[model samples]
Target: MTDTKAQTQAKSADAGHASAPKEHYDIVVAGGGYVGLSLALSIAQASDLKVLVVDPQPSERLRKDERASAIASAATKMLDRLGVWGEIGPASEPIRDMIVTDSKVSDPVRPIFLTFEGETAEGEPFAYMVPNGAMVGALSDAALKAGVDLIECDSVKDFAIEGGMTSVVLESGHSCTAKLLIAADGVRSRLRDLAGIPVVRMDYDQVGIVTTVEHERPHEGRAVEHFLPAGPFAILPLTGNRSSLVWNERTDDAKRMLDMDDFTFSLELERRFGKQLGELKELGPRKGFPLGMTLARRYIDPRFVLIGDAAHGIHPIAGQGLNLGFKDVAVLAEVLVDAARLGQDIGAFDVLERYQRWRRFDTVQMGITCDLLNRLFSNRSDILRHARDFGLGIVDRLPGLKRYFIEEAAGNRGDVPKLLRGDAL
Candidate 1:
């Protein structure tokens, strides 16, 4: 596999003898997005393995954007493990409480409501809100501090596995060999296709309109989720009086909404959001993305594995998408590092199988939950809506059930890795 023309030329440029190979790493990660960068940092910290992260975009460029953001408490622990929570924490907005309501705009009746107060045994928040660029920037810094090689402005041209080693050729005329190769390149991963993995896909017929806004009144670190017939409108707290909005609407309607001027858009937003935050001003241009789910046929191959969105994509209604990727990193890093400690082949099928077993069920369960929620809340049936509201009211009145849900949101409900629990890997 290393004898390919590009690999050979790259090797020759690094060494005097054509027969001798040069520049190798323990693991090569294709795609240096959030997932890949975090995985590289975790692996480098836990083992003596040399890690290489290959990404097409420069690190600096990825740190600026008005894009989709994520929720859930597990992501914070993962960032702490990567050693950047301190830098990121100051910029983040804590979600002190969450209020959920269900009702129609025309109705004057009391809406069925549910509320959760974020709590922790250690007096920390249940979750935080950070921009996409901020998290990636933090990961990039953490990876560099851990001595992981960051190869920016480059992409994997091709890859092959032979003799139990995976070889990759880069567009920068560089070749790297590693025992294991990971694909974290996201939903449209080319490496996943190259590995011949099939994906099961489903389109939600919805588009998420995302933007940041500045309100006249302070949010008091509260997040509000309103379930409308079309979809859910989530207002997540940002620093101070600012907040991030993820409004899921029908695809066709969202396109027209995006085309409207700022004044019209804000008015529509206010109608849905009500006077909770007073006057809302647009903080920047709005963006929208089609919503869908893609699940890879398999998570592992001979010497290759997939992580993050490369392995699975799900509806963002629950806001667990990126947090799920962090869980993937935690599991895979633990499995591989444990194998290395015991003198086991880190890339062996058994080692990779451990990661699959650890992650596959959790990932599938979250995907199914998100899919069901989107379907259940998007419909306008009066009977179904009444039943749903009744269920929410019951859960709201039951403190035990509410606490259980809160614990789950805080990422403390199940078996978790040490790093995910805010411990050293």
Candidate 2:
């Protein structure tokens, strides 16, 4: 594809600014992943804010991510408003329904405790499964087109608040200043640490085995989650007859499984995967990621702020991790844009605090909810299992309650940002 006018300008800026003493931008996001790119794009497109994204990974590497993510309805709305959803929609598979089951690994038959026909009041599917690569690619292209500067193969090594702006030092020794510095870096964010923000953390002692599979039969857009003693195993339908797996297992067992022969791994996978979709072949490389919950004690520090995984990292039991990050992008972008429009200092404590106040409680609540659900369901206690199953069954039977859950899962719940609701800034 040909580069856009803004992309050409960004390329020229990269070359021209390489040896410059110091550069300045309205906002500098210290990570070019989904959150950072989306935040940069949203602000740049909505306003004339000069946004810059710095990341250690190159754009080519970012677009090579093999994983997929569940894009909730609200997030999709935001993406649509950003003008990139048209590119992403063709590659996404809408989730038509979902079923939840709690059973042991050795169980001969697993009965569903909860079944949800995935749709919102507006008749949109609650979520869609989208390739991570597609998401990053589209967001990156749109961000660049929207005049967001991107510096790849470099990252924010450190930064300090100087006067009303934050001075950032990159790993390559280049420096820049921004009205606001955002740490959208991953969960283990060095920028967050540099800002001296403390975090509340909990180790799950579990690892999520993520991979894709091609099945003989189509999934019909049905997503499945099986709650085993070790953890939840999810089968999320992808485009065509493929599905993505987020299989959780104890750390030690996960390590063993990763080292197993393909045949052995396939057998074990089948035991959990079942024959519902008929024969399946593993597609692409599989990876295991350690699971944990990490929430920043404070979301802001002067001109510095945290967003996405840098702010909160939760369990995937409810598939809400990415959605939560999208929420952060929506709220922070809205707050900053509003501040800019009001001629207020976007990096000032009062302005940043508004964002912190709006997001902190929601982040904490979701983190705690995911933590509790992970603990409650990732156990072998028969009494607790029965009680939880009964509760799930009751919730399934209550249409009002089910609708509430569907709305929540769709990210259409309380205090939504205008962007998330498909509105312009």
Candidate 3:
């Protein structure tokens, strides 16, 4: 956090150098993943900025993807601004309520330690379970509608900055220029490395197994998080009779459990997932993602900026990972659009620093909170077990405190950007 824009750019200078220009745009975003795609779409909507999204996958693959994201309420508003949420919202499941429990997977009784009566506002629930396919399909359609160009099956091979422009070269043997370059690539970001950005990487020695389950009985828009000894097992409500499951376990245990035969895996899954939801069946394929935390030393360097996972990767203990990326999207888009409207150089460190300064505190706070929570609850120590549950019980009894926590989880905390507040940029 102490690193200044000048120092970071100076470091980047030794790393990457740009030459000449050919096809030009107002902005060239590297990596057309969710964060990159959302930012590009937002920028294209707010300004006459010619934007290009470079990636290695076509739109069809994105649409057919099975991954799902917990879209915090604030992020839903941001997506609404980009004109995609409306298309996906219908299929998204609103989290009308939530329950928290603490116990071992082998325990007979999983006592509910805390409960939240949902809906932060009228007709607005705390969050929604939006499938990645719906988001990808909506964003792709919206991006095309907004006249944003898509360079599929290709990525930024490298890029250089000269004068006031950043020239980007693709692996497809093409070069283009943009006033500003942003890296929404991912947590393991090559652009971040090329820009000489250092990140604090902390591996949790755990992995999250994600999949959906269909239950015979309805969830009634309810969600549950059971903090077992291994990790938090979440039953997040989705559209219809299905719910998304994020089951975390130690790295070694995860590998062994996943490799088990279907009958064994279902039994293990049922242990964490109770019969309260009637019978349960695993839907589709299950995937495991290694858990870790990564925070870039700096968010901006020269004309290049980092957002989404490229900026920070926190634990899913709190479902705020995607929301944090959307926060970055909202603030960066506002800064860039305002600068361009003022006829200022969007790539200037002076202009880019404003976005960094706006976001750094919030990002760091969330990352630290998640890391601490994962440690606090993902254990069986008698002291922490009793301490955290006592804390949760107190919060549950206090209406005001519970509302504050709900608002925070909804990403409505602190000074939020207009777009996230459901306002147009």
Candidate 4:
């Protein structure tokens, strides 16, 4: 790992900002997506961090709710730290319970049905379902309140690591230098590439079809996960009896599915989904994304660190992608804030190493778990099918084991951050 703090100071000194009189910031976060924005806000609240957020999207036009949604628990706490949770609370939905089942077309039978109920020590629910756009809006508002600088409709045209500091040139012909540079630019991060950090990539040969649907009957705060031959079909609870669906299928089949008419799509969805919710109506257009995993060989270099999808991308089988990103924000924020409070070099390798140690294991575990689940369930083999269904049945019958799985799914069982534990940051 590179000592970001030393590199930052060295770069600042080389840039001679103190002597030349130029605009500089303590931290510059590239890519204003969920992870980037959340991190900027969290860091800004802890210190007069002088954070700058650079993105190509206009802030005013980023508020429209998208069909995509995330399962938030730990993420909620991170948002609370940034003071955006309350703003998005009204539009969010609580998931009180979840059902996991193993189904087969050959037998047309469900061999196992497992139900997990959520629990929270606080008055709040265990997890929330939030739309992507709503999350972005809340983060944007919180960032503004924290006095973080926002550079919209702009992208990093070039970045160079020299003399200990990283200099980034924006497409708008603006140049900025920062003690530390964090890339939340997503899985295909250009910055990470430019920094020469290689990633181990795995393609799952699967595609996730995501959309929201309104059912005749209320969801009653219950979500469902059906393990089918193609992949898992997850129906996450949303507000007003609506459910957000992430249906994973074969890559080639998914392309055809996206072109499916509403009537055909609804029928196909209902087949795996069942008619438990009575009649179902499509709420909006459906979108699909290819599923894959990517883990950067290194999480940090001198004056640079990766967060969110940029650091790791996993299958959505567990709906942990964004939640994991939230964890990154929480851990990175805590580490950086503590370092700053001690007057430690915030960009030093020592400070950045703390974050890497905290998150790397967790990220690898999650990636492997999701990959294994994808493999175990996404096959038509009878032996594996029987074993998985039997495993589900066994867990369902064991109360203690069932509760453990529930808590894990709810993002409550871990070395959690204070914000995730519902404490003030």
Query: Residues 1-425, candidate 2, lDDT per residue (tens digit)?
Result: 99986788567556523433337898988888999999999999989888888878887787888889998999999999999999999999999999999999999999999999988955689999998999998898878767777888788878888878888898888898999899999999988887788999899999999999999999999999999999999999999999999999999999999888888999999999999999989995889999999999999888888999999999999999999999999999999999999999999989989888999999899999999999999999999999999999999889999999999999999999999999999
Clashes of 4: 8
Worst 10 residues of 3 by lDDT: 12-21
Q: Is candidate 2 or candidate 4 better by lDDT?
A: 2
User: Which stretches of model 1 miss by more than 4 angstroms?
Assistant: 1-22, 105-112
lDDT of 4 by residue, 329-424 (tens): 888988888888898877888899999999999998999999899999889898998887788888889999976765676678879876677665
Q: How many clashes show up per model? A: 0, 0, 2, 8
The residue-by-residue lDDT of candidate 3 on 78-125, one tens digit each, is 888777887899988999999999998888998888998779899999
> What TM-score would every model get versus the actual structure?
0.92, 0.96, 0.94, 0.91
| Top-scoring candidate (TM-score) | 2
Pairs in clash, predicted candidate 3: 18-160, 18-161
Distance from true location, Cα of 270 in model 2, Å: 0.2
Determine the C-alpha RMSD for candidate 3 after optimal superposition of all C-alphas: 8.6
Question: TM-score of the candidate numbered 2?
Answer: 0.96
Query: Which wins on TM-score, candidate 1 or candidate 2?
Result: 2
Query: What are the Cα lDDT values of the candidates?
Result: 0.83, 0.91, 0.87, 0.81
Tens-place lDDT digits, model 1, residues 1-425: 44874565344333321222247878989888888999999999888998888888876788886553655676787787677888888888888888888766555543647998876555678888887788888787667667777777788888998788988888877787989999999999999999999998999889999988899999998888888888988989888788889999999999999999988998888888777678888897598989998988789987799999999999888888888888898889989898999999888998999999888888888898999998988888899898988899899999999989888777777889777887777
